[model samples]
Every structure is written in structure tokens, then in C-alpha cells.
Target chain A: MGPSLSIAGLEVRDPRGRVLLSVPALDVPSGALVGVEGPSGAGKSTLLFALAGLVAARGHVRWGAQDILALGSERRAAFRRETIGMIFQDFLLFEELSAADNAALSALFHPRKARAGLRARARENLTRLGLSGTGARNVTSFSGGERQRVAIARAMASNAPVLLADEPTASLDRAAADRLIDDLVTFVRRTGTTLIAVSHDPRLIARMDRVLRITDGTVSGDTTPNTAEGAQ
Target chain B: MMAVWNALPALWQDIVVMLLLLAPSVVLGGVVLRGFAPWPLVRAILWRFRGASVLFVALIAISVGMGIGLLAQERGLRQGTAQAADKFDLVIAAPGSEITVMMASVFLQPSDMALLDGVTYNEIANAPNVAVAAPLAFGDSYGAAPVIGTTAAFASYLAEGHITGRMWATSSEALAGTLVPLDIGDSFTPAHGHGDGADAGAHGGAQLTITGRLAPTGTPWDRAILVPVETVWEVHGLANGHAPERGAQIGPPFDPAYFPGTPAVVVRSDALWANYALRSDFTRDRETMAFFPGAVLAQLYQVLGNIREIMSLLVLVTQMLVTAAVLLGLFILSRLFRRQIALLRALGAPARFVFAVVWSFGAALLLAGAVLGLGTGIGAASVLSRVVSARTDIVITAPLGWAELHFLAGFISVTLILSLVPAVMVLRQPVVPSLRS
Candidate 1:
């Protein structure tokens, strides 16, 4: 319906002045479950970090129409807190807190109408992700699939328009990975939130509404349809 | 107060040494105490200096020692001055071998008294505007115990405030002052060695009866013996039945009354003529020195001013070192815990909040150290006062004013600086590195 993220002339380089990746332009519409596919060390994760404003790079990363990189550091931080939700490939939950607490922590910088009820919302989100009984348990105790769900739940809990996940299903088995992708896609569709998932998994790649291949830091269009029958 | 009190016993037994040693170092640059303070953070810092606190404590100990030494000198001067005051308007004792030691020990001689233009107690009793004049006779000790012989009129000068008994009358009767409280039935035997032993009868000499008792005054009198000067001469003369009758050619080894001549100590009305210029406060006769123990004490403090200055400088130096150590500890510890701090920053905590969390720990350690230093200082002074008084018969009370001030300044000053240094860095380093390895 509307453009959620627009990247133009994205260029990432290593510290020693070696070219790593270059993307001419890429745009993901809102509510689209876009899959970013690449081999190992192909600048997929770096792309995510740069787009999230977590790294220094020469690029134009626009959220809705505003260029996020153009914002001052302080204002950019505020904007990242408000608009961007990130999920690490490793499910980087704080080891000291429970699953629900980790989910709620993502919204720490977000302003809420009733701040006191944030934890309850976090618990509801965890339950919706099949973590109903694991709400109070530390994320460290969870399996890979469960941790992935927790991460996905946390990303969605922020209610940001753009969600960036790094290999969310890389460590999960087929059944669990399918369930996590189903939850993610269902949530993103229901909330009209745009999703960008990085992975090399062909099953996950095939499930996305659209797929973009990143090779030597270059992205190009793939005209594959969203029909599951043809891919199966 | 509760925490301080609870920390006392432990502080004395264990912490005092570290407190002494590290107190200076902490004052100097010891980091361990500043680190590991219990303030919780998204992350906390730690320092590994167990030895630095010791050095800090030692630096402070010197200050404490010098402070105690000064108090000792002052108290000595006080007792000495009080002694010189009662001896005469001023005491004309031998100047000590050294200038410093001279003030600490000086005694009036009999020949020195003869040089004064003074009158005896009986002669001055009727003088206009005269209250009383009590002559002092000191010399001959009984087993190292000084035997002071003075009249009842001397009691008023010795008494600082209220006491139990009044001055006594009659030659044989004497009153015990606060310094030496003797019951009415107590008898004082004159110490021997003077030629008056044969006429005085037995061991030392004549035995004097105690007729009255004095109240407890916190002055030097509490430690001195009070008796009539007449008894002193009587003891010297050995006034007994054995005395040679009417000067009938008496010599030693002949009759029981025959005795050898010893040093003469007497107080007569006509022989002594002394004028204490009451109008002139400090300027007294140059020939005769009226050593006010208070004045002597002030002078001694001035002389020892250098030592006091050294001690104060040491304290200041240690304070600087402690500040540096705390700063270093903060920087290193903060660096170590940067990731966690960033995480907390990400959690919406402001820079001030993060800094405050870390500073709370430093405050706790400093508080512990301060309590330790103070407890040790006060306790040592108290025990020393008792021991010195017991052994030397000198009542020297340690002055707590400077000790307390130094402790307060040291504790508050160092603690405030240590707590504040690490906190300021938070303002500049607010943004956490986006990807912490």
C-alpha cells in the first residue's frame, strides 16, 4: 500500500578500504514479508545493521519518506527507538531476565499511553507466540526455536512499522522454523508491518511474498510469484 | 550511628591496618575500595588494589601520631606549668641541656628562691589585698614518689573548683588535695636520705597526720602530695625525742639524738621577699621565670609547628592519591563494563542514572574507611591517656578537636571527590557503541 523502506546506492566497505557490497536501489512496500537471501559473509547482516542505523556507511535509508541517516545522532536514536524493531540471529535476550521481560525491554524507549501495563502486553505477546507457559523462564533456558519465537515476539511487541530479522529460522528445525515464520508473517500482515528477514534457508526463502538475492553486495529483482503450489 | 558502631569492633581488629595503610593510598590512588562498591548497575566495576588502602592508612596514621604527640607535649607543659606556678610566681630551675627538652623538664632550686624579693606566708598574710601565700618545699622522694610540703594556704591556689574537704590548721595536721586524696586517718611518712632521719625517727623520717581531704579537681594536684612546709623541716630536722638536747655537742655515731647535717629546706617570713608583678601579665622578672604551664604549652606547640605541618601535608598528599586511584578505577572499571552500561543506556536510563549507580559503590567503601580511621584514632588516644597517667603519674588528655576535624575533612573530602569523578564521564559518553563485541 505504501513504501516502508527505501535503500538507494547502498555501499558497505571494510575498515581496510576494501569494497564489500553495493546495492543500487531497493524498496520494500508496507506489509510485505520480504526475504533477503545470500551466502555466508555476503554482507546480509551488515546490510541489516547499516539499515538499522547501527553502523556507519554511505547510503540513503529512508523509513516512510524521511531519510533516517540524515537525522542527527540523538534524533536518529529516538527515531530508531520509535520506528525500527530488530531481531538478532542469536536471539540476544538479556540473560538476567525472563522471556516476557526481554520482550518488554524492547519497548523501554517507546512512549505508551499507560506505561504501567507494558509488562502485561509483553506477556500476552509471548503467549500468542506459543510461549504461554514459558513467559517467566529465562530465554537462556529456551531451545533455539523457542528463542527465535521470543525474539520475533519482542520485535513485534514494539509495534514498529519496520521489522528487521537476521536469520530468524537458521537454528530451528523444519517444523519449528515453519511455525516461527507462520507467526511472523501472520503478525506482520495483521498489523500492516513491513518485514525484512535475512536467511540462506531455501524453505524460508520460498515462503516469503517476495525474494531478493544479495551477491557481492548487489541486489536485483526476482520475479517469483507468492504462489506456494508452484514452489512446492 | 548504628552502622558506625557495628563497624567499630571489626574496624579495630582487622580493618585498622588496611585503613591506616590504604587510607593514605586511597587518599593517594588506591582503586580497589572505590571499585566493587555495592551499587548495582546494568554492570559494576572492580579494582584489585588490596595494598593501596594500606598505604593510605599509613599516611593517615602519621597524622594521627603527630596529633597524639602534640597533645602529649601540651599536656606535659600543662602539668609542668602548674608545677612551676605553685613553686613561686615563677620557677628558677636549671635550663635543660637542649632548648626543646628544657621546656619539658625544669625544677626550681632553693638558692633560686633566695634570689627573689618575696615574703613568707606568715609575713604576707597581713599584706593589703593579700589572700594567702603558701610556700612549697619539694626534694627527697620516697621510692621515686615526690614529697611536696606546702601550707594550707596553698590549697586555695591548687583548687580549681569544688571539692569534698576544706584546708586544715595546726602544724602536724594536713589536708589531702584532689590529686592525692587521703582519708583523715591516713599518715604520710617522710621519705629518708636527708640527714633529718635520726631526729625524725625510723625508716624515712617523721610521720604526718592527715586532718582534711580535698575534692576531685582535674588539675595536676590530683597527682601531688599536700602537706605543711613546717612538717618538711620537721622531717628534715627529725623532730623527735632523739634530737640533741640544747646543742650539747652533738655528732653522728655518738647518741641517738646526734645526727649529721643534710640539705636544709625551710620557709621563713623574714628570709624570703618575693614580688609577683600581678599588674604585668606576661612580663615578669627576668631573673625569676614565672613559667605558666599554659604559656609553656603554647610555646611548645609553636615549636612543634613544623611537625604538625608535615603531618597535614601528608594528609593532603594522600587525599590526592586516593582521588587519582578512584578516577583510574572508575575509568578502567567503566571500560570493562561498557557493554552493560550501553545496554542500560539502551534501556532508557539517562547518563546520570548510570553514573549514580556506580558512584553509590564508591561511597559505601569510603564510609567504611572513614569509620575505621576515626575509631582507631579515638581508641588509641583514650588507651594512651590512661596508660601514661598510670605509669608516669602525669595526666595527659589527648586533644580531640584536630583529630576529629582531620577525620571529618578526610572522610568527606575524599569520598565526595571519589564519588563525583567517575560520574562526570557519563555525560560525554552517553552513546553506546552500536555493535559491542
Candidate 2:
């Protein structure tokens, strides 16, 4: 089962001491499909980064029983490896590696016995995502949409409980984006995985069970479209 | 273990030392990569920047090759020259430069010097414990080959009984060296001097027949032609070192009254103590000087050894500087892939894993270059040996030895240790900022 997240007094500041992101309180239940929406420079990506414990922030970000923000950098990386899978906007793939190898890159740091399974799963994920024969091709030769799908496959390869994606479909065409949204939602529902994605795409946001809208580094709206959970 | 090590041959001992010196790098690599296999990633990086990798490796190889080639060539030359003089145990000459006489007699390099007169030669020949005292007459040439005149006993002793045919039985019969370009029974007229300045017609019609050939000695003597000393004296209008009543006898037991002076005399004794005694007795005489050719060669080798040490130091320093520059280049190259490194970090890869990737990348290049440099050194040494042999007529063989392997081991260990610097610098970069960039 995916872990629930409980956060409080979360804030991120820039080098010049200006606030970049501030979240007073937030709660995400297990297996929730949530969307974060905001204009440019609205701290949407920063929030995703903080949730993954990738940036320095002050607060309690308790995923299940472990407070990730209170842990050291090494422990946080371990937490991310075991529990959180992240997808970035630009589809950061090693250009020199084949699509399958890039998808299974985490196998490099995994235990020796676990590496083969991870690689097999990565290839399976690529095949399921419409990249069957392309798994052996280098990512540098991939189109923008194909590269984005490879990044999605990589994020899901570990079967991590919590997945945080920032603009995952921004580089894909409308048809590819729709296909990706269907794949993500079906995988989340079947596996009871919590997926929190930050995107400005209306189609993506409308499919989420819960949505949070932020403006100027502060949350402005919170709603459950299928339920009666009120705004913040 | 100590006993076992001591029981091994010298070459084996050096091989063990070379392996021991490389152990630290190997152990460190194993520890650093304890749970990780960074080779795939390292291979990718190497292939990605193969141009830079090749450039760095070539730079290292050339420097190492030059250093090892020079050392091997120096050792080969020393050994070759020493081996050339091996037969000349002691040289007795007029009160003058021992080097000049040694060169004239042992190396067959002709030079003008005062000769040891009949009295000095008679004393040396009759000295107690003197097994063989052969006069050397060297002032003639046959083409580019020097024509030396000495007794049949000395010629037989120098060849170590490896002559292909019987020793010369008459003054007109000659023994050709292995490389003299003459066949048995072939005859040649002697020139009065060496090189282009030689008087080719000076000995008009005074021909000497080749009756024997010496086995290869891998020395300057390989190109010499040997005849009886009486032949040299008679051709120059001097007495044949015998009374007229003695007839045409060519062996020894010469009459001092009829002996013509010779440029140098090579002396030997069966007993080591007797050679020292002979040297002392010959040196005490005011008319002549005696010295061990081995001792003089040792003194020359000491000087050569000192120069080799200095050259080794300079090469070492230059290699270190080049390694440092290459490592710094590695740092800049690592920056080119900073984003990829940052991405790996964000994907929850441990810092040690990334460090291993970069460090192993650098270490692989160093090791490849070092191993390839060994071949380059051997090839370069072989080529240089041929050139030196061609120029000096001394067969020098500069095979790669334990010293070059030790040098390679030390280079690999030091550079592998230094490789950690770039890995650490890469780790110190901020992951989030790099990812963003």
C-alpha cells in the first residue's frame, strides 16, 4: 500500500532569503491521485521537490511513520529510493545509454541479487508504454514524446509507492499525453500507488481525484472534484 | 614467505615487486566499488569522450615510452661495451693514457701513442704467473674493418675455442671476425690506416689469406681481422720479433734484440691473485703502465649510472606534471557531464556510486595508457638499439626489464590515487542546482 503524507509548517527560501514556497499544512491519504496546478513561478515544481526531500526545507514532511525532512541527506536519498519515484519536466535520461538501460539505471546502486529483476521490470514497463522494440535504442535518438515516456517508465520501474512528477506530459503531443494519462491512472488504481503530479494541462488536472492550486508560492485553492472536500 | 621470495630468481623478484606496488590501487578500487558495478557507466563515459580519452592516453604513453627507452638503451650500451672488453683482462702500454691504449687494443680503435719497447715487452712476456702476454699491433685496416695483429694463442683465447677453422699457421694467414665480410681462404691487402684517410696502396701486394673465422662476440671485435704480429711488423719494414737463425717461426719465444715495439700488450693469468700481482709489477715499471680493463669500465659505468639517475628524476617529474594536467582536464571533462551526474544523484543513487563511476573512469584510462606504454617502450628500445648498433658496430639488445615494470606500477598507483580528486569535486557539487542547470 502507498504511504500517506502529513506535512506542516513547510517553507522554502531562496539564497537571498526570499520565500520560494510556503505550505502551512497539508494531508494526502494513501493511494490518492492528486494534481498541483499553478501559473509559471508559482512554486509548483518547488513543492514537488520538497515532497521528495530533494531541497532544503523547514518542516515536518512525514511519509507514513518516517519524517523525511528530519533525516540526513543520505537517509533522505534512501527514503526516495525505497518509497518515492520522481519524474522531471525535461525527461532527464542518460543520452549515451539505451532506453532500457536508462530506465534501469537505479539497478546500478541496488543489491547484486536485485539488479536482474529491476532490469526485467524496466523492459516490461517500456513494452507496456508502447516502446517495445525501442528499449535497446539510445535515448538521444528518441523524439520528445518518446523520451518522456521513457522517463515515465523509469519512474515506475521501481514500483515505488509514491510518485512525484513535474510536468511529465509537457513535452508530449495531445494524443501521447492522453495515452500517458490513461496509463498512469490505470496503474495507480490497480496498484494503490499515490501519485502527485504538478501540471498546467487541463485534461491532466481534470482527471485527478484531488487538486490544489497555488499562486505566488502560497496555496490558493483546494478541492475534491468527485467528493465534497472543501477548499482550504 | 621471505625464504620463498629469496629463493626466486632476480627476474621473478622484480615481477613480484611490480605486482606488490600495484596492489594498493587494486585493493582501493575493490573497496570503493564493494557493492557497485560501475563499469558499465564508466565504459559509457569513456566512449562518450573517447577523443579526450585517447589524447590523454597518448600523452602518457609517449612520456613513459621515452623514459623507459632511454634507460634500457643506456643499460644495453654499458653491457655491450663491457662485453666487448671482456677478453682484455689487463692492458700494458707505454707511460701514457690507459684509456687510449685500452681503446686501441680492446676496442681496435687506432690512435697514435708511444709503443712499449722490446725490453718492456720481454719483461711482460717472461713475468711470473703470466699465462699469456700477446702484443697488439693495430695501425692497419681492411676496408671498414680494423686489421689487428696478435699471436695465435691470444686469438684462440679470445674466441674461447669457438673458431670455425684452425688458427692461422703463418704470418700471411689471417683470422676473420664473424662480421668481417670475408670467407676462409679469401685474401685482402692491408691499408696503412683507418677510414677514408687510409693509404690503400701502402702495403702494395702484401696480401694476407683468411684461414679461420671467430664466432660472434657481440662486440666491436666482431668486425676485426686478426693476423700474426710478425705480419704487421714485417709489412712495416720492422724485424719479425725473432733472430734470423730462428727461421719463419710464428708462435712465441721471440728474441728481445729483434722484437719491434708494439702499441699495447694484453696480459692474462689463470689465478686472480696473480693478475693483481702482475698489475702491481707492471705498474712499478717507469717505462710502462698496467691496469684492469674491468676496473676502468666500472669507473665509466659509475659516471653513466649517475647521469641515468638524474635523467630518471627528470622523467619522473615530467610524468607527474603531465598526470596532474590530465587529471585537471578530467575535472573539466566531468563538468561537461555535471547534469548527468546530478540526475543520477536525484534518482537516489548514492554519492559513493557516482564517485566510483568517475574515479573508475579516470583509473581505466591511466591503466590502459600505462599498459600500452610498456609495448611502446619495448618497440622504441628495439628501434634505438638497432640505430646504436648500426652507428657503433656493437650489438646492443635493450629488452624491457623489471625496472620498466616497476616504473609502470608506481605510475599507475599514484595516478589512481590522484583520480579521487575529481570524483570528490564532482560529489561536492550541489545536486539540485546542477539538476536545474
Candidate 3:
């Protein structure tokens, strides 16, 4: 299959003269669990931010044939809503909302998307993440692991074509992290959607279809994932 | 209207009424619903602005409510005063201000104005088109009510107010109004003068008989004690320690100047032209002040109306300024919520999401305040009317009509429209910078 994502000559710089991120060329296949790994201050998150159109960057970030970065701000936001799901390191779940509402809020902007439909999908996502029947509780009542699952549920509930999860399991224990990796791989395989995850854990990175590392503001060539971990 | 009135949850109807009044403006916002929906974002943001919303609604209620209440009370006061005078066709007193005499006779307020001579009474009665005339003698009180000394004809002019027993046939008898707490054959001694000790019983053993009680007319007459002029003369003689009878009897060659120095005289006429002519004649006389009571009432309303108009303008301006300040504060508070707005925007919400969040907050505050104020103002006015009736005989009957509705509409419209300013400002703000910060 053709690459689900294509990047070309993308570069990001701070207002000062320092370059923060650079990628010459890259392509990611659909349904691939691509992992990004980097040391502290290596511009890993910056590169992810640029790919998500959350930061100003030079050059092209195309989803298939469409250059999403070249789209107008409004259209880009709409495209992001419809196509790209984001899971941040800190878990950007809305604290004021119940877990269900936090997840359902993502789909509300879609035309003809009824509240009932969104909540049903959100409930399905929450249940898949081992958060069954916890939809009505406020997110503040949830544990850190529970909150992370809620964030994942919010990202996945909208059924966006791509998910950019930065350090998706950073705050999780080994067992919870392993479970999340297993769940994410299963979700990707079923939906045939692109999953680009950044993690410091070798166990998480090792399960990816392909892995890319950021070193000295530049991305390294891809490495094959541990087939044993993927199979498990 | 009945359906709206049924919701008795303290000012809820006022809020609903205010919203209904502002429906056209709110409906204008319906156009935005086609391409965008921001209610989710609106609901969340309002949660954060809960305290500000309370403050906003409270301000609106006081400003708008007080405005409405004052206008209503003034209208009632004006109408009640006017209706009180509507009974008497013309009031004749010793030459002075016509309104002063009308106020003294119909309103029962004691004044220092000169009293009409018995000659003036005779002249008023004999005037063209004059059907009946009755002399009025004041300066006496009986238990928080005025003792008005007039002939039997005075009761006829006070519409719908008739005696049950009889119209005080002898000088010692009296007729009390419905509010006076006296019935047939109830005898109470007269008080000395018009002061607080109305039951001081200072008159020299002049026990007055309540021959009958008058029915309620919803006017100052509902609070009076009617007696013949002879009873008052007898009471005055008892107070001053003089002879019992005011003799100058009723026959030909008898003196018409029997009750000289009587405080007032009321007349009724058949033809409008004759009444006008008599009024003109008496008004020109150096001896008497003639009042077409309606004209005097009109003058009173004109003065009060002008004052009320000024007060209304002041209230309107104050409300506008307060609303503007509230909006300005809202705009500033919204800036504090910029991070939230940016977060919503980042969540792929449209600019309308931010706008709706801010606008809904502002609108809710103003609407709540306006409604609360409306109920408070109306309730306060009603209470004040009763207090005034109990303490002084002046009755206020404030009207609620198109004018009040118009004021309410204007209030809601202005507030909603002003809220848009803050909404627009929030909508136009750069989303990315706020998120980053």
C-alpha cells in the first residue's frame, strides 16, 4: 500500500536563530504502528507538533496527496477535527467535563453528529480502554492511568484517520503501558489507520512496525520493530 | 398571560418575560445556527464564569426593576389623586390657589389657606347651572380619620358611596365611611383638633352618634366621618365652651351667611358651559377661589409627570452606564479565559464557539438581573401603596400597560446587543498565542 503520510523538506526554528527540528524526507505506511524515540531536548515533540500543524514549520506535511500544512487555518482546523486525533503527554482531558462528555466533545463539531451518537461512540471507546461504566464520572475522580485511558478514548472515539500520541504511556506503569501498546496495536490493525507514537520505553518502541529516533535535531533512518513483541 | 403568571418561583416570570421581550434579538441570532453550533463550548465556559454571571444579572435586575417600579407607582398615585377629585364638579374656597382648595377638600389634607365665607357658598349655589352645593368644615379628627361637616348632598356626589342607616338627620348624628370602624348607633366623643391624639376626647362631652356607615368607594372618602355642619358647630362650641346650637335657622328672611368661615364648598352642575361660567365668575371674585377640580388634578399630574419623566431618563441612563461597565468587565474577564477559548479553538471549534461562550454568559447575567429587579420593583411599589393609604389618605394605583412592556423590551434589547461587543472581541482574538501562553 502507498504511504498514509508523506513529509518533504520540513524544518522548524524558534524565533531565535536556532533550528529546532528538521526532516528531509519521510513516508509512513497506513496501519503501521510507527514509534518515535529521542533523548531529552532532541526536538522529538517539536517534530510531532509540526506534523500535527500545531506549530509553524517550513515545507510540506501531506496526508496522502493533500498538503495539510498548506491548507488555510480554518480548513486545517476542520481537517484536524475530522482526520487527526491527538494524545499529549500530560493527558489533555477536559477537567470540567464528565469522562463521557470529554470524549464526546470531539465529535460535536461534526455536522449531523447528534449528542446521543457521540456519547454512544465515546462509551464504546471507554469500554474498549477498560473504563466501562465510568463515563458518567468527572475526569478529576479518575486515577492517572484512568485519565490517560480517557484521553485515549477521546482521541479514538472520533474515529479520526490518524493519531499523533506523544509519550502515550510515559506516566503508566509497566503492565498498564504494555496493555496500552497491545490495545493501540489492535486498534490500528482493525481500523487500518496510522498510529505515530513517541515513547521513552524500549518495550513500547520495540513493538512498533517501524521506529524512528530524533538525535541532534535530525531524524535517523527507520529500524524494524521486534517481531516477537508485535506478535504478543 | 395566565400561563406565564403561573410560574411563581420568585422572579422566574420576570426573567421569562424579559427573555420573551428580547425574543426578537435572540431570534436574530438564530441565523448563526445554520453553519455553526457552539453550545457545548458555551456551556463549559459558562461554568467558569459562574460568579460573573451572578453579578451581571443582579445589576440588571436592580437597574431595570427599579425603573419599572417607579413609573408604575407614579401612575397609580396620579390616577388615584385624579379619581378622588372626579366626584366634585367645582370646589369653592376663600380666594387663593385653586389646587390647594381641591387638595384640602377632596384629599383631606389640612392647609393654612383662607376659608370661604357663607356668602361665597350662597353665590356658588345660586350660580348658573348649579344643581347642588354643600359647605365643608374641617379642622377636626376622629380616630385617624377627618370629620367632614357637609350637608346630605355631599354623599350623593361621592359615587357609589351611600349610607345604609340614614344621612345624619340631626346635628348630634354622624355617618362613618367603611374604613372608619363605626356602624349604626355607635357613639364616640369628638376629638379637639387635627393632631396625633385623635382619640384625646378633648371636646366638652359632645357624644356623636354614628347614624350610618358609608360603603367603600376606593377613594379618600372611604376614610372620612360625615356629619351635618350643625354637629361640627356644636362640637366647636363644646371645644371652645360656648352655646350648643348654631341657630340662624332655615327659612325666608333667614341669614344665608350662617356658616361663614367654612373651609370649603363643593358644587355640581348639569351643563358644562354653566359650570365653566360659574368657575370663571368665582375665580374672578376677590372673595373666593373656584376650582374646576379636574383642571387642578390635571395640573398636579403635569408637575408629577414631568418629574417622573426626568426620573425615568435618569434611571435609563444609569442602567446603560452600569450595563456598559458590566460588559467591559465581562470583556476583561473573557480575556482571563483566553486560554480556555484557545483550548476550545485547538479542539477544532469554530470562532463562533468562542463568541457563543462569551455572549451566552453575558446574556444570562443581564437577563437574570433584569428579571429580579422587575419583581422587586413591582412588589416594593405595591407595598408602598398600602403604607401610604394606611398612614396618609393618598392612594396610588400604578398601571402596567404598553409603556412598561416597551421599557422592558428596550432594556433586554440593549443588554443583549451590548453583550455582542464582548463576544465579537473574544471571537476575533488570535487563538494560537493564547494556547501557547
Residue range A56-170, candidate 3, lDDT tens digits: 7888999878787898777777777767777766676667778988887755566664556766878998888788989989988987778888877777666777888878888
Instruction: Point out the higher-scoring one by TM-score: 1 or 3.
Output: 3
The DockQ scores of all candidates, in the order shown, are: 0.11, 0.66, 0.38
Span of ten consecutive residues with least summed lDDT in model 2 chain A? A223-232
Writing each residue's lDDT as its tens digit, candidate 1 over A1-232 gives: 4347888877778779776777778877777777888777777777777777655567798888888767665566566656777775567565556788677764444444533356676677788778898988977789888887777676656566778887888778889888887777766676777778888777777777788877776774554646663253
Better of 2 and 3 by DockQ: 2
- Model 1 over residues B364-413: C-alpha lDDT tens digits? 44555555545656566667766665554445565555445444555555
Runs in model 3 with CA error above 4 Å? A1-3, A9-26, A34-46, A55-57, A89-96, A113-117, A166-182, A198-232, B1-24, B35-52, B159-161, B197-202, B238-254, B332-340, B432-437
Off by over 4 Å in 1: A1-3, A31-41, A86-232, B1-161, B164-276, B279-286, B303-306, B345-434
The number of clashing residue pairs in model 3 is 7
- Tell me each candidate's TM-score: 0.61, 0.92, 0.85
Model 2 interface DockQ: 0.66
Specify the highest-TM-score model's number.
2
| Recovered native contacts, candidate 2 | 0.62
- In Å, residue B192's CA in model 3 sits off its true spot by 2.9
Q: Rank the candidates by lDDT, best first.
A: 2, 3, 1
Q: Estimate, for each residue in B53-155, the C-alpha lDDT of model 3 and write its tens digit.
A: 6677777777887888887777777777777677788877788777677778888887777766555666777767887677777877887778887777677
Q: What ranking of all candidate models by DockQ puts the best one first? A: 2, 3, 1
